[model samples]
Target: MTIVETTSEVEAVVRDTLAVHQSFFLATSGSAGPWVNGAYFAETGLFTLSLVLEQRGRSLAAIRDNPVVSVIISTGSPTEPFLQAQATARIVEDAEADEVRRVLLAKVPQVEPFLGTPVAAVELRVLSWRATDIPNGWLPGRDLYDTSIPVAREHRG
Candidate 1:
């Protein structure tokens, strides 16, 4: 199989993968060191991911101290691998918290109980991502970021 390398190609894969995955692994670091946690997420537009975190978790604390974070999302298909994204995290302001929570609930209803607890609404701005399709080397892998290639329209319609 041919490898996908163009910016649009990579974006398409990333979009598709994100569409099929509701949860991802979030990695963060703070003065105490590094932490990784699984979180249920919701996506807005093509590049933003939103999630709610307990106000006092290590991951949340790390994000408060440093916004840089990484997220890994899988396509949820046995045939596909995972997508690793490097992103910047930001706490949603009170003005937008309700809307963010609404979106998150729509995607993951199980989070309802946790919502009652004090939590922070966070948004992850994707900076770059990578995916590998190396099933015995049948297809080459691709690693790309926002600056890896010039942004271009994906469709003419």
Candidate 2:
């Protein structure tokens, strides 16, 4: 398989991945340290994910202390050992409490009636993205695998 080399191509694949994978790993770090966490996410836009995070949880607290965070979401296909990545995370949130909550709740219907929920709202803005293909053993190429070629096979007598 050929790796994408253009920004538009990257964006399209990332957008597709974001649509396919609703849950992504959210990693956060504080002034003192860094920690990784997982959660179910909803996309607010092509490159935006809005989720209601526990206000006091390590992930939320860390982001509060240090807004920088990392998120990874792979194509759900069974690519194993070579699944393609969508994008990198740079967590951004709404300053207006209600707005943040609104965006988060909009994506998650179950959050509709949780008015008193103590979770902070956030939108992870993807900063940079990377894409790679699985290594199919045979022909040599960039990695240990060879690139897949396009062709049409015909069956004839």
Best by TM-score: 1
lDDT of 2 by residue, 27-126 (tens): 7768758787776677766545677677678887777677767776754443522122223343444465566566655665566665466666666654
Weakest 10 consecutive residues of candidate 1 by summed lDDT = 148-157
Report clashes for each candidate as comma-separated counts: 0, 1
In candidate 1, what are the lDDT values of residues 73-106, reduced to their tens digit? 8655536866877788999978788888999999
Worst 10 residues of 2 by lDDT: 148-157
Segments in model 1 whose C-alpha atoms lie over 4 Å from true places: 1-5, 75-79, 136-140, 147-157
Candidates in order have lDDT scores of 0.78, 0.54
Best by lDDT: 1
Predictions: Cα RMSD each: 5.3, 11.0
Question: C-alpha displacement of 129 in model 2, angstroms?
Answer: 1.7
Candidate 2: give its CA RMSD in angstroms.
11.0
Q: What would the TM-scores of all predictions be?
A: 0.80, 0.60
